[model samples]
Target: MGEARYSRQIPLIGEEGQERLGRSSVAVVGLGGIGSPLSLLVAAAGVGRIRLVDWDLVELSNLNRQILYTSRDLMRPKPFVAAERISLLNPRVEVEVVHEPLVPGNADSIVEGVDLVLDALDSLEARLALGDACQRAGAPHTYAAVQGLFGLVTLIVPGETPCLRCILPERPREEPAFTVGPVPALVASVSASEAIRILSGRGPSLAGRMLVVDLSSPSFEFIELSGECPHRPPEPPPRPAYFRRGDRLYAFEADPSGWERLERRGWAVVEESDAYVRLSGPGSVAVFYSDGGALLVGSRGEGDFREAVGGDLEDL
Candidate 1:
């Protein structure tokens, strides 16, 4: 058993570290491009128990970087496919697959027994929900995202370090349409390496800092997170209307739902004809589309929308 399976990693992580890994539990969310390889590394590394979560089905477009699946596996639920692969890779590693999408309501139970959580999601909404769940669960989470040649890795240790929400108050509104090609491999490799380091209890984890990599530029940079929590005044009880367009553009109001109700009543309407939607309210405005996708205009026509959205955008 020892001759072929883990000889290469033995010297680095050692039998003790391997044993530790075998005893620890890890939960990986989103079994897509980044998640596929990341989960493989964790399972192959001898992680004692692995919990996989994803609601998405495999698609042909994902084969370029999702190493866990092939043409034969297309259309199958990702968590199921990943679990099957992990068992074949190492039966010693117990694999648990949560086939449904993770939401705020079920996040606590999903993360309950895991020592670490890995974010491999494609949408900011899911990431934020996971972050909130991890925080409430007091579990450490490692987040990774890639777009084109750029990738980002961040480690959040609940109250010990800055939470994802603390650093990014608002979720990214728009998703970027990107070409995967070989970028996911690079990002997933780096993210998996970081997870290994965490598992071995070796090296300084990328906690409290965002590790940004640009493969096109072939450059790596670290952005220090502000330790102080940025505080925002509480909105009035009813809450205001807010909608995000594309990755960076956003419109908000003291009452966001009011506009939605008005839209439903046909009192307010946006022509979806031009790839642009009109969001009306205190923050009513028309968002323009760009080559990248929808331009993120924040709070209607405010020039500050661009800067605010640009600064908070995460590429995945």
Candidate 2:
């Protein structure tokens, strides 16, 4: 508890809080602009074990905002250089490097045994996957992104609060992001601070609130995000009842293959052609076609198909 490294903030968080921070393990999933400062801050705060995850290499262009690398480190793998820098900042913190891309097949392994997961990824797909992985692992997740001079940060607590997917239903095509130095630094620090609070048991956690910042105006906006995780495997579309070919139509009574369904249903055959097949039920005329679409013109008391095809009058 006599660590002078955290002396200035020790008064606020206390020795016990510092001990908690020193015992927590956190995984940062991206090592770009946001993850750079975020990992640095978390390590500097003495987070016990830090996992630096990224698949890209450092480039001269990244020097604009990614503070962990220098021009001398160009073309070098990011996670290694990041690990080196973080170690220099605080050797007491244990650092682990994941040098591969985060894919669905390996996301679970990356989050394994971590107390918290931070989302600093640029791609929408990776962000969603990380969120789901954290949810499944029951790890607290912090997500943040920066564009131009604006940035946003949110805290996601697995099944307890709205996840990243709940807020974004579709994955957007990855596009080049426009950002300056200060925006991502601000967002990253905010995310790191939130992680610290949550890990130190000193949080009025941003569990359901998103902090949005517009540094151009030096303004901060708080958005309350609430809901359950709405992510589920999409259901397959239902098979069609009938289909049309040219001006002819065909219907299926059972199996869509050939006309076996109609034969099984005992419907009278009205006509048959290479393009269309027609069937006659007691009071209805059914048309089926090779294209797999079907149409039925039936009586008033029939099934919902009557209303589905715009009712009986239109059928006439």
Each model's Cα RMSD:
12.7, 19.7
Q: What's the lDDT of the predicted structure labeled candidate 1?
A: 0.67
lDDT of 1 by residue, 1-316 (tens): 2446889987887777767777888999888888998899888888888999875556677887788999996545567779889999988889886755555556667788888898888888667778877877788888888876788888888767788778667766655637464677777777777777887777546888888888787788999875754432222222223444344344332222232333453333443323223343233332222112222222344444333233222210
lDDT, candidate 2, 1-316, per-residue tens: 8578999878888889899999999999999999999999999998999999875656677999999888986645577778889989999999987755565556778889988898899878667777777777777888898888889999988778887788777766676888899999999999999988977879746888999999889999899987677765233224333332222222233222434455465667666655346566655555454444344544434444444333342222
Model 1 quality (TM-score):
0.70
lDDT against the true structure, per candidate, is 0.67, 0.74
Off by over 4 Å in 1: 1-3, 230-316
By lDDT, the best candidate is 2
